[model samples]
Target: MKTPACRIFLFPAMVCFSIIFLLSCTGQKIVSLKTLLMGMTDRTGITQTPSPWYKLIQASSYDRKSDKVGGKGWFANDDYTQFSGVDSSKGRKEYILLDSDGPGAIVRWWMTFAGEGSYDGIIRVYIDNTETPVLQENALKLLSGQLLAGEPLSASVSPETDLKMRGHNLYFPIPFLKHCRVTIECDSIRITANSRKPSIYYNICYRQYEKGTKVVSFSKDELLQNAELIKSTNETLKSSGTISDNLNLYSSSEPISAKDSINVNIRSKNSAISKITLKLSAFDTEYALRSTVLKITFDGFQTVWIPVGDFFGTGYKKTTSSTWNSRVDDQLKMESYWMMPFKKSCSVWLINYGDQIVKADLNIESSKYKWRSNSMYFGASWHEYHQIMTAGAESEGGTGKHRDINFADIKGKGVYAGDAVAVFNTVEAWWGEGDEKIFVDGEPFPSSIGTGTEDYYGYAWSRPEIFSHPFIAQPSGSGNFHAGLTINMRYRSLDAIPFMSSISSNIELWHWLPAIINYSLTSYWYVIPPYEINIK
Candidate 1:
């Protein structure tokens, strides 16, 4: 059963109202675009679970036939042109993409289209019980950085990708108070499998707040009001490697021989790690990148264990990419900007498991942080499956023996930050037909399930062109359609999932062909103490 939204808020209704009034003289707190944009870069905000926490929900164009577990058409591939209902009350028909009652905010919108005349439709967003649409623009232009906010927040992946094959994405937050409806007025849409009309695909992620929570609905006026802040936020996200002057830096250079390790310890009383950078040199740089493991212990508890490459989003290769949380440069220097809080002490280690000696230069930055009740320690976990075999999906003529591969099974209260996957395909066939299935707080069914692996990574059509953004990136895509290496990563801010107890994340290994492949997953998160992580 779905977790009731009422049970998520522990405080009394009066307390919720009090907090809102504290933010403004106007009795209700306005969750404006500025409020959400500022929250995106606030590292400390994610640690403290909100008093009236919001649940992350996803509305996607997944195959409707997959509604029941172990039912027929569970693995159907017709994930396009599905609608909630058709609204024709206004004299013209509008296909409903999403209709929900809200004290909520839409955080991420990813879409793509195929067939003829697909990208010409106008997308309308109606909010707060208003009959007039707050936003009405060409669907492609609105999502692909042409209509609203520009690059990173609103973007299409891989400039090298063919225009029609690219996945358009918008990360700008769209808050609503009473209700929100998204519809499309496209005459070219047809539901028939063989229809010549365009096929639309989408995955919309939103946050549903508890009832009675005050939220300011999105509008053109709000967008105009927050224009300057939006630009500043985009700048900050783009320059994630900028070091803050407030932080104290600790630098070290050491050579670790085969089967050896080096450590850096910070014994500050009330401090947090603001940034970490590491550069490695070896005879075989690629092998060293994969074999050298980065391990971190916060306040006596080990919380992070992953390879240097995967942890930094490069995945065994020194590919250049940048995001709000992590980045890799042309010189192969990798930096991580996750805020890791500690009460008294923190320890970081780099262990070389390979035969070659590796030289490492590390830079650690820390700043004063006040310990709070909701403070959480940052964590990351990674594992690799060698020579894993995949059975083709039945839709493509092979046995549909796809299986869910666990990324991370975290036990304890925490917020899921982000994840990255590296694949080494052994054949030149599309290997990412899988969908992400994430279960939070021991829910009977996954609260967040995706349409496809590529869709979940904010891209579409399995195009191999490389792209980079502040939140999502494909550092390398050679393996996406051929037998090579591919790396896909996604970082979260507004859409970060907070679990009161546990989170289990899995992605189906739905390869298109029966082939052997190498797959590795790295998951990033933050959890309170007394936590257990299944990946080691």
Candidate 2:
């Protein structure tokens, strides 16, 4: 929600004092590497390092030239027409931006639509520069009594709001940011149903709004790291005798053409694989598989099998080439992440129940594990991500088996478990795409993090795959309003696609299955260029 800043002006006085921040390194500074990593990685403030950094800016209201065209949105609401609300919440529109106010930066932001709005929908944003005015605009909507699982029970402004349907939310124009703040204003709210679970939809966007300057929505270095994350994950899965969930493959015995798949038949009498899941190796990599699915014909019934999207919070989707859904066997319920490589791997799993899988096909594509924002988005030093990558519990989602992983427990942890660790001159998520990979020594970091659909990525954006941006995030601290429990203040995602129109169906439009493994963002980190900090 906030951005980091670099020291604005140079202070020669810092040179006289051995303030660690002032200098790169000492000739012989004595400090434990782990301790140094811990200290240096504490990104809990605005300008941890110094000037020439970036931050996120929110908006209250603003206007677009009736004749300008820079970016566009798909919400399909008239609310985005103008930035009004000069004073009254009647016509003014609000916008927000996530940028350094560089050239060509724009933002498209909206609030959580829970199908109930008796008043102005709430808008709370993370701000970097408090001095800047937050753009405020009055966006409005009418709610219709309706409900969607995982979404608010009410529906609106979709399929063209009318007497039969409703306008559920006031879609704000995308915000523009030079500096940031969030603006909220609405009136006359109504609710027809309860949102079964907290939706992860905090829809916002970042674009270059100014001329000549392309506000990097995300750190370029970080994006690269994210891209490389895929290869790192691929290697880990391959080494562990597992397959990357993004990879689609067929039995080595069969040849696969571009986007080709074979029939997997399950006969009534055959001993079909009721369930199959690939346990990811976590000792080396921290990628968690989500939204596991299956496709097969069992008992004369053929259908794509899909599980609840948050099944333990981890499953894969057709990221690149393969698209998958699940087929259910009421009598036999099996769920697993089986290996489906894109190319010729030696073998594959089979569920032989009178059904002959003429071909065991796999879908190989890039799906992402999206995290909201690391304490910041881009790349981090090996020192960063130590706590997040390690296991622990989310205040709201509960804790998991935080298996302390390192070289010490290598043997006991697993055979392929890595031996030694080192710093990589290269980062894991070197791609803006947010795909990053870790490195053990100079090789691919030998690790994987797997959560059953029941765990990690289970709660919408709360899952590690789609919106677990911790480097730029922190534990959602507690507030007096809600005691005994804490929600992650940093994690964010939009309510899954709202009814584009009344014509949209949950099954057909929203893909409401709680089992789609939305995304799995991976990045690599290594202990290189040793550095330390005094986190007071």
- Best by the lDDT measure: 1
Report the C-alpha displacement of residue 378, candidate 2, in angstroms: 16
List all candidate RMSDs to the true structure.
6.2, 22.1
lDDT of 1: 0.84
Tell me the TM-score of each prediction against the true structure. 0.93, 0.24
lDDT, candidate 1, at 48? 69
**Regions of model 2 farther than 4 Å from truth:** 1-110, 113-118, 121-182, 186-359, 362-536
lDDT per residue (tens digit) for residues 173-231 in model 2: 12222333444433432212332222112323332232422122222222232344433
- CA lDDT for candidate 2: 0.21
Summed over model 2, clashes come to 168
Candidate 1: tens digits of C-alpha lDDT, residues 176-254: 8889898987878766655425788888888888887777667665676678888888777777764555688888898
- Report the error of model 2 at residue 37, Å: 40
